[model samples]
Target: MSGLGFETRQVHAGAIVDAEAGARVTPIYQSAGYVFDSFDDGVERFAGRSARRAYSRNDNPTNVVAARRIADLEGGVDGVLVASGQAAIAMALSALAQAGDHILTTDRLYEGTREMIRGALRRQGLEFEALPIDADEDAWVAAVRPSTRAIYAESIANPLGEVVDLALLGRVSARTGVPLVVDNTVATPYLCRPVEHGAAVVIHSTSKWLGGHGSVIGGAIVDGGGFDWTAAAARFPHLHEPRPHGAPSFAERFGAAAYSAYLRSVVVLEHGPTVPPSSTFLLLHGIETLSLRMERHVANAVAVADALQDHPAVARVHYPGRADGQAERVARLLPDGAGSIVSIDLAGGRDAARTFLDGLRLVSQMTHIGDVRTLAIHTGSTIHGKLDDAERAGLGITEGLVRISVGIELVDDIVADLEQALDAVLAAGERTATRRSAAAQLEAVHP
Candidate 1:
């Protein structure tokens, strides 16, 4: 599998032939528990002395196959399948940090992730700090506290499309001995592999591009298996502390696989955010065509961004592929393309945004990204609606901002639909202005 190319691996990496039926594709082992040869075998499996599937909550054959495929794609040493992207994040963070610990992240992140950190994780006694994405290495290092357990960021940020400097963060990770965990949901393994740069862990929402059609909801955590947890023992006591019955610490027992082992055995098993065999099947099928879909996705995105940039109704276009301050970083990180999501701010603000969304014909109005169909959403009214006006503004989610998950549809068709929608917005704005002028004149004459 290590010698195989990405496309080949995606199809065959974790697949196993069914001995009894001679099935070609991986069969979904939908059972909750696997039968053991005997009591001794069951004990050995439970005690970790033997390697076999025990229970579906922590390990399942179907889920393992999908997890392994993602691991291969991300160049990770090991991977874990979970119920959702949020579960992947929570499991990864819980594996390393406990109460009274801190985690540093770039301000640009998915709205759900931001909510998770500030809401649930904060309630669990973890502290999170958000810093600017373009902060220098020294600034990032300075932000690190003695209690800092991890550094987190997205490979390519959502909506705003900011690309992180993985190498700089990797250097900081090396100097500070904190593992860098990246959410590679938007960029996908097809566009970027965070581990290749310096990330110790990578997360993905398989519901997005990995599932390809938005048909399934699943998530995965890929461990690079390179971070030395023992060296950072003081910062991460859980990895260093001995097992309850005098067994070796996770760092001592699993070595490079310590964090992954802890996440799978302790966090995922106990927390019960397990990925189902059915979802894994869909994710595996989706991954088989990941490379092909991503190529078309990127091409369409470039076309859409270009069209949006010159539109009269658009105030600003937020796509990394464009020439901007982040252009160099984008080129270095996303040579193939910036990604399939393009966000634009409408010139006429909220009312025009509503009109544009209402007038769209071909593009679907939805919250999801990475679907085969083009989707659009007003971020200010939906994803970031929970935040106050000031908070939303700070995050670059303006009232007029619209995020488009550019699909693999023909470029001309997509552009045509968007152009017509923009035209509707402009016309609506003109009508509103005319009505206001007429009302003001009538009021003055009557008075």
Candidate 2:
């Protein structure tokens, strides 16, 4: 399979033989529980001594299919399917850190993730420090305190469309003995597998690209199985310590399986952040077409960004693929295209941004990205709206910023709609400014 291509793996990796039904496609085992042959069998299942299933919360056939498929796609040892992308983040972080532990994160994280780190976890006594994604490598090394548990960042940040330097961050992880967790939702495994580049953990929001059609709300955390928890024993007591029932130290018992095994048997099972088997099924289906869809998505996005850069109402376009103004981080990390998301700073600020959004004829204004039809969102008013003025500013989410996720739609039609929208906003802005100036002049003369 290592010699096989991604498209081939996406189509063929996780289909298991149906012993009872003779089904080619993985059947949806929508049941809440599974039965054992005898009382001793149940004990064997609960003890993690058997491969058989015990409860839906622990594992399910449908969920296993999804997890296996995702693991193959991302080159991970195993993956845990969770309720949503946020759940994946919560479970993954909680698995690594406890109360009084600290997490070092990039400030340019997705809005909900930042909220989860700074807002929700802070109240629970867990601490986090935010640093610029493009900060000096030494700055990252210096930020690691004795209590620092993990370093987290997105593969390609939302709205900003900045690609992170995985190898450099990997160096930080190696030096500091802290695992690097990355949210690969934007890039998906189709474009990039962070694990291949030294990420200890790769998390995803299947609601965006992995589910492809935006039909399912799901997420996954893939374990690279390379981080040695015992080496950082003092920092991560949860992984290093022996279990209550003499269940063995996770680092000793599982070794490479430490992160994922803990995530499933401990956090996911106990906290109940399980994805419905039906949702997992949807995600698996979407993954089958992931490679093909991502190619079109990137191509369409490049065309859209190029066209938007030329529009009068577009002040700037932020797509890492552009030649002259490209972020050097992108070339180092994203050798493939920068992904489908394009963030543009519209010329006329908030009001003009709204006009451009309203004038768009074909692109739907939606909260979700990575769909078949083009979608547009104004970050300050929609996705990042939860952040107050100061927070938004800190995150570089300006009032005029419009985030567009290009789909498989015809590049020509998409550009035409954008052109019209931009033209309308600029025309309206010029007229309004002129009218206001004329009105002030007339009032002064009459007075």
Which candidate should be chosen as best, given lDDT against the real structure? 1
Task: Give me candidate 1's TM-score against the actual structure.
Answer: 0.98
Worst 10 residues of 1 by lDDT: 320-329
Write one digit per residue (lDDT tens) for candidate 1, span 355-431. 99999999999889989999999999999999999999899888899999999989899999999999999899889
In terms of TM-score, which candidate is strongest? 1
User: Which ranges in model 2 have alpha carbons more than 4 Å from their true place?
Assistant: 321-327
* Candidate 2 local lDDT, residue 166: 82
**10 residues in a row with least lDDT, candidate 2:** 321-330
TM-score of each: 0.98, 0.96
What lDDT score belongs to each candidate, Candidate 1 first?
Answer: 0.91, 0.86
lDDT per residue as tens, model 2, 1-447: 467788898877867878998988788888999889899999888887778989998598888888878888899888888999999999899998888989999877888887787788889789999888877779999999999989999988887887777888888999999999999999998778888778899999988888989788988889987887778888877787887677687778889988898889889999997788888777888889998888899999988888888787888888874643445767666767789998888878999889989999999987888887889998898778887899888877888998888989888999899889989998998899999999999999996
